[model samples]
Target: MATFIKIVGSLIETLQKILIQGEIDEYENDKQMHCDARLVEMLDRLSKDVQASVKFSESFLIEKIQFLEEVKGIRLPLFIPHSVFLRLLKKKINSVSEFPIKFVNNVWGYLETVCAKVLIDQCGNYPKLLPSMKKATEHVMSKMKAKFAERVVEMIEMEKITDYTCDPDFISSYNKLMNYHAQFLNLLTSYMSNSITVEGYGSINIRHLSEVPENTRNQAFDLKMMMTTYWKIVLKRMVDFLALQLRFFIQKVVKK
Candidate 1:
């Protein structure tokens, strides 16, 4: 896991370097043209590398799960070990996949930071880049929706109401279920809060907008609005899903 994180960190660093160094040259001369071409090429290469790294990480995690299930004979439908769950909870979200929310958040953070730097450096000159940036943001939000769906499924499967009566083991399982639900809700709430905060720029970056020209402020505001909408929509969907799950659990408990 340490090695995987180090690899991801290295990829993010490379992406940062590419974004910083790939500045558009002002001169229209042949030398400037060559430099611009080279920078574009480098950016493309770095983007591909980052995508590949994310894919590799996802595959590694899946493989790890498969190993546990196949080799160790661990059943997926049963409750996950507390230690394993703790380790999973520690993972930072990635932008690429739905399984590890923290890694998704980290990836989005890096992308937004670099894209904001580019926007500031270019002073809103690069309209072409806006679509790509928006797409990446959208992709992360979509993955978040999928992540919530996955959580709902996992929670449902883990829930076993054989006897909701006062059996000691059943009581312990019920407590565990409640605890996991609370933990997930807390995680989602924290993610939403941080996302809208000034630091994360999951919403509008007022400071960044101030740095740009007045004409570009509208564009920046629009981008902010779009991001804010996505966040709200995804969060609402997650909340609704959790509520439904809670309703079912409550019904089961009451009936039993």
Candidate 2:
């Protein structure tokens, strides 16, 4: 019974090591959940920065309209060309795809700096080990950054193909944006008008958009609203996802 008890205790300890500390190293320890407060503060700031700043290209409107007009095909009345729309959507995605990767790089770059400081502070007692530890950290961060960047590209491609979300906000947001359709047209047609007030978007010059051909305007309006709504959803999800990735990364780094 004593022997069995020791065996069970040994097994539990081994499992703890595997599940908690993972592969032990200079950085790994039993407290898997431990993370520096600086990381938390940095992550919060990053989330706000991404949410506030990232958006689809403003020029996408003119570019897409031109492309659509160029690709405009003979079609039955009121039936939009799904293929053309898909291609246009892919183009928009491609244009905005780099933003996520850039954010990822910035995040990882900041993380590397913070982590280097951490190593310096923690391992100041052992100056000889700092070089190797810092090197390992950089190597790990680089690999993780590449992996994340690749995933972001894959995500953009997948979004290009199709997107589905159960969020009622999708429909709500689309309807709200489309509510401006008549107003948008009115503003555009008003020869004396310099700008139009758009909800969420502050007063903006319509002079440039006003020049879009009348024949193409309707489709352009619809496409713009749809893509705008989708971009909002995509950006929200990207931030949420990056937040999760940040946590996973911090935990993984801690475990290392």
CA lDDT, every prediction? 0.36, 0.64
In the predicted model 2, the residue pairs found to clash are none
Instruction: Name the regions of candidate 1 deviating beyond 4 angstroms.
Output: 1-210, 213-216, 249-256
Using TM-score as the measure, which candidate wins?
Answer: 2
* TM-scores of the models, in the order given: 0.20, 0.67
Instruction: Write the residue-wise lDDT of candidate 1 on 26-130 in tens digits.
Output: 323424223335434444443443333222121212333432334333445343444443222223112322322433343334434543443334434545555
Q: List the residue pairs that clash in candidate 1.
A: 92-102, 92-103, 93-101, 93-102, 93-103, 93-104, 93-105, 94-103, 94-104, 95-104
lDDT, model 2, position 200:
84
Candidate 2, 1-256: lDDT as tens digits: 5543443344334333432344333335424323344345555765565456334344535765777778867786355677776787677667656666777776677666655655565556656666776787678778777877777777767778876677888998999978987887887787667566667876656567876777677787687777777777766776677667766765565445
